[model samples]
Target: MNRKTLVLPAVVGLLAPVLAACGGSDSGSSGGDAIVVGTTDTFTQLKTRPAPLDPAYAYDVGTWNVLRQTVQTLMAYPKGDGAPQPDAAQSCGFTDSGNERYACTLRKDLKFSDGTPVTADDVKFSMERALTIKDPEGVFALLSTIDTIETKGDRQVIFHLKTADATFPFKLSTPVAGILNPKDYEKDKLREGFSIDASGPYTLKAEVKDKSMVKAVFTKNPNYKGLLDVKNDKVELESFPSADAMGEALSKGDIDVMARAMTPDQIDKLSAKTNGDINLVEMPGLEIRYLGFNTEADSVKNKAVRQAMAQVINRGQLVSEVYGTQAEPLYSMVAATVTGHSNAFLNKYGDPSVSKAKTRLTEAGITTPVKLTMHYTTDHYGAATKKEFEVLQKQLNASGLFDVSIKGYRWQEDDYKTKEQKGQFDVYGMGWFPDFPDADNYISPFLDKDNTLNTPYVSNKIRNQLLPQSRREADRLSAAKDLTEIQDIVAEDVPLLPLWQGKQYIAARDDITGSEWAINSSSTLQLWELGRGVKG
Candidate 1:
């Protein structure tokens, strides 16, 4: 799923003082009170597809945050760093030596939000429907490894893969593998409306919508029998019109917590202890921002044009001038914190040079002052997105070899369908929040034949040879060589340019507990970990 951009302090030392000052041990076992959490992330309901809450159609962070509470997957991520633990399954493992065939045994007497029993047939049905429907905006691409799913009796489910894929277990830990009740969902179509029937810690009580989702209400599920402990009785997720509105809701005592939508200025003020009643918590994030070029567009179709643009843009100046201390320049599509990261882009392009950029364009016999259009989402990311694009336009126009125009569109209403999916722009900005914490997750989705970018980037070496070799290795770290080669190939092809990576931050009133644990490493909100506590 893609994430909305949020900024945090780049230096880790700056958070030490703030963490020490806001010290109180929260066991997530406090007062069972209802809390209102506010964010700027909104949802859209399309006429041709199902609602955003359906597991088959949701591919954004905002909708998955809600689904994490209502839909249970076979395996789940622990609070920090570790292997995935069983949630709905009692035991699961690869049955073959080649990591191709996997099997799981369901826990005895598991029930959904309704009183229906959860069987192995329902698990098989849920996965098959997602792959069969193949929603254009969905995460079915993550399930491309499975060749078949088989159910044995009523308690066991087995998966047969086309090839050896070591990352299949991690994929099952994501929300895309969420098990659905067979009776509530169609066999080959997305379930309409916002209602869901699943076995998780919380249930969807109600939703408020106005063209897009405005608010959602979640309560404790009576029939939920899972491995997680539910700490809160109820939670109200409210979507504010803007970042300022969300921050004001926290200040006015209307909302108990503010998650992932604060502007850089707001974050700075909070970090300086301007608000005595609020506390800020920072977590390590794997979020990244990059620019994708339309390979078929007339202006950027030539590989030399994309390579020249990559060489001319200055990442250091962009981060310092616009983002202040909130972000760091990224040199690889795989984030620096990941296992197999390298400075492939930095090694290829070095520092920004206008002379080198001009020489590359001239050698290709391309015309001077190349015309291109750059597009970005106006409302989805944050207020700084507009300024970010403005700085990009200034830099490109100053290079004297390119003519650039910048445009902004609202994400839900205009940008997603009309602009991005249709490839209406020469170059566009996009953000990625990883589906799982793996280097393969970073490389495959953008460069594969059927990619999420909606642009064709056909790299036969990457899709056929390198990717297959990497997936066959059981130890993921041993596949670093193949992953490094993939990054170097991307640097040469220049299908996308890596820009900056961000850290995660959350702010809440003093009475609210578990703000630190609400969002996991994969950026999914675990609402069951939140509760109200005594005021300091």
Candidate 2:
């Protein structure tokens, strides 16, 4: 799946007061009434394609947050440990020892929000359309392993893979594998506009948009048949321009919950609150931030130059200065929480040292003060990104071995399509929210020949040998040796620099139930779990 990027209009000022007046009371209704959710995430539109709520085109976490409520995947992760469980399917498992042939039997009488019956054919159509359309900004790459999709009558669906892949089930659980109604969505093109017709806990009642989505209203789908027992009857997801605005909206009771994009300082202040009106829910997050290199670029093409820069950079100081306690230093492409993670970068480079960086560059017969340009998005990640990049510039320039300059661009309009996707920057900062909570999800998307980053990272050993071997193991933990070696290779090559891993935070009213269980490990929000608590 594509990395999570936020794109909201500057209408927070206009939204807060109006929403506050119309907001519901803190008490629960017997039928479970509507609750408003606040976020800095908004609907993103590509220059060439339609707004990305369609299953075939949607990729990022923001789109998935809404899609997860409206579209049902065959398999899905439950509230507890991150494991794929049957959602639309009554049962699913691999039919072969090679982990190549997977099969699923659809639940009896599953219907879409529009009252159309869901069949194995719908599942096949959904997967086929995503691969066929192959939107450049979409998550088609995640489904590339499927060689063929076969439907056995109306109930059974089978997936034949090109190679052994234990992570296939986990991928199917993501929104990229969200099943679609063939009658509603065209097979060869992305469905235009914000309308949705799928079988999930909720259906899109209305969407307010001006250039970008300002609000989306969702209502419980009475025809929906799935694993989720949706708690609320209705929900409204409101978008804000900044984290401060999102927090302000939550503080003033304009929104019952603040889902994402809150600053560290805001979180700290909220945590220190002695009042019983608000609750801060913290969960283990799989989100990570890193700096990627364009191996074809003149400034950082040389492996030695990338290695030198890596040696001089300080991850501890970066997280401490910019994120405070909101994030921790990261060392591997695979997050520290994932099994088989290694501190390969730290083990190789040790702590940040200018002398070591200087020696590495001098030994390579390179000139002093290497000119480097770093690129970052202005609006996507959060407000702290600017300060983070500033700290990075100061760190690199302080070494006296490199001269760094930073540039910012709007994520959807320019940076993603024209700059980063085309590999125009020598060095660029990006964040990764894993498609699934697995080590392979973290590694393969960035290291493969045709990676998500659009950088020139063609590793013969990783792409051809190590990754294939790891996927063959049915027991995921058994692939640790290969995974560790891959991290070692990444540390030596330095195609990307690991920076910090983030924790998920959700601030909600004290009366809001299931606030702690709202988001799963993959960073997809489970809006079905959110509801108002009963009064004493």
Q: Can you write out model 1's per-residue Cα lDDT over 372-451, one digit (the tens) per residue?
A: 88999988778888899889889999999989999888877774534676778779998888888788888888876556
Query: What would the TM-scores of all predictions be?
Result: 0.94, 0.93
lDDT of 1 at 203: 83
Measured with C-alpha atoms, the lDDT of residue 46 in candidate 2 is 55
Which stretches of candidate 2 lie above 4 Å from their native place?
1-32, 415-418
After superposition, candidate 1 runs with Cα above 4 Å error? 1-21, 24-31, 48-50, 415-418
For candidate 1, which ten residues in a row score worst on lDDT?
A: 8-17
Report lDDT (CA) for all predictions: 0.80, 0.80
Show pairs that collide, candidate 2: none
